[model samples]
Target: MKIAILGDSLVAISTAHSLLDQETDAEVHLFTERPEIGLMNEGPGIFEKWPPCPNHWISDLKSQEPSEGSNSVRRSWFEKAIAIALSERGCIIHLRTRCTDVSSVHVEVKGAGRIGSGRIPFDIVSDMRSVSETSTEWSGGVCITGGEPKLEITGNRSDGTTELWWSGPRKDTGSWLQEMKWIGEDPRESLTSEIKVGIEIARTLVDTIIQKSPGHKIE
Candidate 1:
């Protein structure tokens, strides 16, 4: 199967990981507006469950530091690990690529460098980009170097600090939710629930693939 996942959000990474875990032969393509992953955010992060980039992707998961509750790989490592893992496994990573349009079976992207532009075809196209800024009641802020963390939302890192936001995507973001193919329910901790969301989407993809199989019957 071929899939085009929009965005480099952990959700997107997890979705790709989960899909490949279930369907090893699947062809996965990830398009991210960022030049790369890990550059988005830095430092310690907390996840209810750290989505493994799949055990085989990384030779030593322990080196990445996984823990439960208020625990995660340093943001940079986690981000890089998943992206690198996917890439090493043959998932085409399109960096600095912006999606210009989306359809049932294809995505049109405007990109930089090697990925000039194209309408890439896929068996499925999913938008896993975070809708925090667009789909929720929110406020943006910045956490300078040595600044006490006060906000729940965080953005990218720079010189000696990190940027944060006060709000996150919610279940109801009005028409904003319509901006993507699948935006699941947002939980108390947005990052935490994303793993399940990705897995669920993977199941949907698998089911769809099964149904699309020749000679398959729905009953």
Candidate 2:
């Protein structure tokens, strides 16, 4: 079976990995226009903490310290690590390419610049791109920030240090629960916990696609 996943977001990468882990014989392909994997180039980091699974990707991120200068550099390293891990898993990754169109049986893709275009046959296709339409007035700070889960720290000491306080959930940000599996009821929890939830959500989606489709050789 052949599967194609669009976008370079964490969810896309996770879905590819999950499919490969579950269905070793299936061919998983990732399509992205970016030169690298990750959404950092698009905006702020969506993954502020380690994801749930303690795989090589998570381990590589955990091995680094946060105080290592700019977060962009760290994020880049993390992204590269994930790409490497994905390649190791035998998932075909097509960088510098974008999926122009997708159907039940195939996907059309265009290469970077004048490189040309082609189509890839696939049994399943997963669109992992971020939704562009969002209303801040309807969701507050959460919607304004692309609905990325965050950990906000409050209360500060006089010495520039802050006291740890309980995290609070933003009331307007629960809309994602309707579409994705949330780790907990609150989004103000630790970033690591939220990331874990994201990973699980991606895994669940891939599992559903595999199970719901008959004669797919997903097992």
Candidate 3:
């Protein structure tokens, strides 16, 4: 099966891995405008999580040397590393490519100058772009601004350690409404937990799709 996954978020990456795992012969392509994986202007604290797999992508992330001084530089390094890992895993990644249109069987994309535009036929086209329309209410003082609202919550755990989490929508572009980030001691464990959540969400979505079409092969 030929599958084209849109976006470069963690969910999109996880879905691509899941689809490839199910069918090794399946051709999977990722379309994104950014050269690196994940959001280009994502915050430093926010990290990309990966679903459980035979080759743990996080291991590559953890093994990287702390050569970069700035957090943004480090994040870019990690994102590039992830892109490499995905490529190694049999995913054809099209960097600097944007999906102009997507239908049931084909995805129209435009690349950089000289690369031009092209259409790729696929058995299934999954839109993994994140959309945020859900409104969250917190107990603290909430302030509405012209741009995206920022909400940060900090609580003390039973062990006396402090836990911090924040969520807000992307004000720049894309369908992503809001994104959440949690501070954890271990990046690997935190990422693993997040990936598990992503996988469950993906499963639910697949289940719904399968329910509609009982004969579809998704697993």
TM-score order, best first, reads 1, 2, 3
Q: Candidates ranked by lDDT, best first?
A: 1, 2, 3
TM-score for each prediction? 0.67, 0.57, 0.56
Q: Which candidate would rank higher by lDDT, 1 or 3?
A: 1
The 10-residue segment of model 2 with minimum total lDDT is 136-145
lDDT of 1 at 131: 69
Please report the TM-score between candidate 3 and the true structure.
Answer: 0.56
> Which pairs in model 1 have colliding backbones?
none
Q: How well is each residue in 15-126 modelled by candidate 1, as lDDT tens digits? A: 8878888888889999988878864554333354445334564433444455332233445566677678778878888988999999979999899947699888888888
Candidate 3: tens digits of C-alpha lDDT, residues 78-153:
4455567778888888888888888978988899724469887877777777653344422211121222233344
Q: Give me the candidate number with maximum TM-score.
A: 1
Cα displacement (Å) at residue 150, model 1: 12
In Å, residue 73's CA in model 3 sits off its true spot by 14
Estimate the TM-score for candidate 1.
0.67
Q: What's the count of clashing pairs in each model shown?
A: 0, 0, 2
List model 2 lDDT by residue over 1-219, tens digit each. 777888776556766766676677888888888876752331222233333344654434444323322222133345556767888878788878977888877889898634359877877777767653322211212121233345352222122222121223444444332211122233233234434544675577567666767776753
